[model samples]
Target chain A: MSKNSSNPFTVPEGFFEEARSRAVAGASEVRRRRRNAGIALISGAAALAIVVAAGTMMRSRTAARLYDESAGWLASAEYDVFLANELIYENGMDY
Target chain B: MDRVDQRFEKIVQEYSEPLYWHIRRLVVSHEDAQDLLQDTLVTVYRKLWQLRDPSKEKAWLFRCATNVVNHFFRRKKRELGDRTLDEYLEQTLRDSEYVNYTEAAGVKLQKGLLTLTPQQRTVFTLRYYDELDYGEIARITGSKPETLKVSYHNAKEKLKKIIEEDE
Candidate 1:
């Protein structure tokens, strides 16, 4: 095949240089974005873990407090029943 | 830079002009060609590790370039709602910058090229201008060699008629 010697297109001065730099810079930008995304992913995971741990700790504390309150109420009721029985025996009103 | 970056730089320096012209002939605009070349190079840099055989670098590079050009056309087609790709390309040729109207024959040839379909134009340019063999083009374009030969023949016939009528 016969090759055509004439070219109709023209480029700006230093266009190749400019394009080369831009290409490299664009690759660098991609790398930077990937790195940033990875960092964000790790940070997100860490934050989620912290939140879960805090929630678990708070839930454990709440359960302990509820248990203590229930135990105290049961003890107070037993003490009141024992005192009422003693008063009845003292007054000879207990069969 | 590092070793990989150095290798990428070498690739850019070596293939930039050839790839630019390869893209320019298909896209018909300097700006679009430049952008596509840059995109191609950046892709090459990122995917350089995938290249197991260094012997196929040229074919791989051309493949990347073709893919980028195809994507550009697809996007333009979408943006140009209700209009065909041929019409959009014709408009682009009319309004494109960095073109030499002084080269009347060259300009005429480019116009004739635009008259052909995208596949025909690509096959013709790679075969006629870039002087790539049908096997290489087949690898780059992922088309059968017989198909490319037919496209090139048809493209040549069309361009010949267009040029003959213009004379």
Candidate 2:
């Protein structure tokens, strides 16, 4: 164990106090910066999430509309086929 | 009462001189050490929130100081390539007689420290000059206590050799 004084290194008294005050100020500045960055990130993330959700909803609504239109067209084709069969039966009977 | 101001005052009253002494030994320049010491405090204050345990504050402070010194070393390396630590210190060492124990040790210890590897020198400085325990040194330097033991021993041997040669 090297005695404390035996080891070379010394500093004036009160220097530590000055350094400490500086450190506290620096730390406060860092905290402020971190808080600002965190707020910006949160806001940015929330906006992105909202945009993605809206895009997904719009796409699903468009797909559902297309499906409804195809269903309506298919029903019209079925009605036409039924009417044509009835007409052919009546003509056969007359012949 | 402002908690931060009070905390800062308490810490300054407690560790500033010790930390200043430690940094002065490593860099071997009064002006540089003073600057680094200020930087160290700033780092400590900024990172103080990360310290969950109050008991570990001392160790944390020294860890920050070590990082500040390493940063200084890195900047020096970028500015002056291929310059040895000894050569750097020799060029920087002042010719006037040192007025105090701290100043005197600053020169002799830096000269002795040159004999050790960078890691060994750091270990020795933290352990001996700074009077940090093995565990504290380990925390500050990120070396295992067992590794610090080995490094300290190696550093002591090298320092003894260097000091003897000078004698």
Candidate 3:
């Protein structure tokens, strides 16, 4: 059998032309899908980064506020202790 | 079109018809062959960079086509539960579009070809129809040239007997 030998199969008229077009189109579609997927992956990574940054900022702000409140409470408590000592001393309650 | 797209378009123009015939002979359906050819070309586009040796490009395309056909039959087998590949092909030949039914000998030849094992069928078609040498067939099929020679011989004998018996 040779390449020119006839086989039983027959394609539709103009099938090869159509097949070439379809193949080119199909390859283009694959490239398009890959591009879309790459874009989506990058977008997803970016969105994740933004979410992480926002969460970190919010957490840091909350932490700073909590630290300020704790320091203020400590200062007031120290002043009260000092006042109590002064009252005791002023009240002649020292041993 | 960029360089890669231009290269791919050239490939599609060059190899589509031959690949289509190769796949049509194996699958025995124009629609299936078209779909498989498209898949093969798409695969070639995706993996073209992996082909280092331009001299082996034809063999590589055929190899891709052969893998696609194998995958098709595997998926078809799973879908067809207990119905053999032969049965499926027979049904496809009977009902598929774009087949030349007027050529009784050709149809009989295809049936005979289908009776061979998948390896023998592939080897025979690549050799007999595509006129590929044993080395090229071996490259496409990943078989030793001697092994392909034996398979092709066996397939030829079997098909001869089948066609003669039909006559």
User: DockQ: which candidate is best?
Assistant: 3
Docking outcome class, model 2 = incorrect
How do the residues A45-89 of candidate 2 rate in per-residue lDDT, one tens digit apiece?
999999999999999999999999977876897867766787778
Higher-ranked by lDDT: 1 or 3: 3
User: Lowest-lDDT window of 10 residues in candidate 1 chain B?
Assistant: B88-97
Which sections of candidate 1 miss by over 4 Å? Answer: A1-4, A66-95, B81-83, B94-97
Which pairs clash inside model 1?
Answer: none
Which residue pairs come into collision in candidate 3?
none
TM-score of chain B of each: 0.94, 0.87, 0.96
lDDT (tens digit, per residue) of candidate 2 on B1-167 = 36665676577778887888778767777778889988887766665558888888888888888899999988987777788756775565543223244544445656677757778978887877677899998898888999999999989888777766765
Candidate 1 lDDT over residue span B94-154, tens digit each: 7777887887888888889989988898898888887889999999988999999999999
- Ordering by DockQ: 3, 1, 2
How high is the lDDT of residue B96 in model 1? 72
- Measured against the true structure, the TM-scores of the candidates, in listed sequence, are 0.80, 0.67, 0.86
* Model 3 spans > 4 angstroms off: A1-5, A77-95, B95-97
Could you give the CAPRI-style class of model 3?
medium
Which scores greater on DockQ, model 1 or model 3?
Answer: 3
* Model 2 error, position B94 (Å): 3.3
The DockQ score of candidate 3 comes to 0.49
Cα lDDT of model 3 by residue, B1-167, tens digit: 77778878888888898898899999988888989998999999999889888888888999999999999999998998989889989998887777678877788888888899999999998998887899999999889999999999999999889877876
